[model samples]
Target: MATVILVRHGRTAANVQGVLAGRTAGVGLDAVGREQARRTAERLSVVPLSGVVSSPLERCRQTSRILVARQEHAPGTQVDAALTECDYGTWQGRSLGDLAAEPLWSVVQTQPSAAVFPGGESLRAMQARAVAAVRRHDAAFEAQHGPGAVWAAVSHGDVIKSVLADALGMHLDLFQRLGVGPASISVVRYGPHRPDVIATNTEFGDLAWLGALGPVADAPVGGGAGHGAPRADEPAARKLAP
Candidate 1:
């Protein structure tokens, strides 16, 4: 089986300010975010990684750099637009507080499955794109390196969460229930069948404990449910399929 490590980008100014970044440019990691990346790098450096991939977004690219730098393996790192964050469209750069003032905000919080960002993407669309991106990564790595290869992907929170949900066969409307903290690491192993999650929302400090024992941690809790949470009784209205 090939191991895939998914990392959420470090915090950003927008994250701190609680603004929607969507697909807008100019959003980059804040200082705390940088530190988070560095810590993650320090933890993953010991893993025998074969490759590293990142979203074209600046924040994810920067996080990938740090991760690659910490490794002695000198793995290949590439950028892929498929891993980009969800497009907020008109919501880009808008504050949550401001958006909350609108009636649409309630719809997004309660029924995001049906709400679409004005002139932007739907939650369903974001999940589809993220699932495609993850499958591409899996296919490429398996073709080039075969089983036992370990690869890392650096991306945004929403993108990472969506991909994780897809791996677990969860639906997109449940996306809000999953959370990927800054620089958090989620792991999955791919074989002939569906991918299996090793962990989700794992902190950098947890990596050191895992590394001390071996390259990977014990099988994740909840059998790949995002962050160890139980699966929803009813799958979300929006599927994570492409």
Candidate 2:
């Protein structure tokens, strides 16, 4: 098992303009986005992350760079195709206001399981691939590092939300209930038995508590994790996975 920190890239020009920048190439982070990236980097710097992976999108890559730069010994961000933005097909670069008027918008919101972006993939496809990708990366890192390994994936809002919904054992259609803001952090502890949703859509927090135990420099293994949370135990979390 491993703890996966899911981060949505900072706001982009498209985000500011309410455009669906889906897989539209060259759309980088805007000014506000840079600031969010910097703050997120500073906030996550305390944790000894084993690896950083990101979607193969420029905005996500930009956000990943800021985070990797602040880490003491984090591996450079790996651009995983699995983490790419949902292929919105004809919807790419379209305005949100325009999409809102479309008949399928309601299906997307109320029954995402049935949503298929015109000329693109279905929501169920997006959920399956994103979940598998994150799970694969999480298990691999933990196997290489140890039971207590941690990593982060910088991805799109819907992708992260779908993953969280699965972790919470909620249906894909209910995923809209989960939110992921730009540069926000959502954590999940994936175990052999089940997954735990640690936090969701949080903008800021001093993760000093992350360094409070096991393989963490200041605190020794077996020491309790501070900030009122229990220690992170892979084997123990696995017992709850089912």
* Residue-wise C-alpha lDDT for candidate 1, range 171-233, written one tens digit per residue: 766767888999999987665656677689988444432322222334656655543233344
Pairs with steric clashes in candidate 1: none
TM-score, candidate number 1: 0.82
Strongest candidate by TM-score: 2
lDDT of 1 at 67: 88
Question: Lowest summed-lDDT stretch of 10 residues in model 1?
Answer: 208-217
Provide the overall lDDT of each model, using Cα atoms, as 2-decimal numbers: 0.78, 0.87
| lDDT of candidate 2 over 1-242, digit per residue (tens) | 67789999999999989999999999999999999999999999988888999999999999999999999886756889988999898999899999999999999999999999999998899999999999999889989988687789999999999999999999998999988999999988775667767689999877765544343222335744545354455477754654
Off by over 4 Å in 1: 205-242
Which candidate has the top score in lDDT? 2
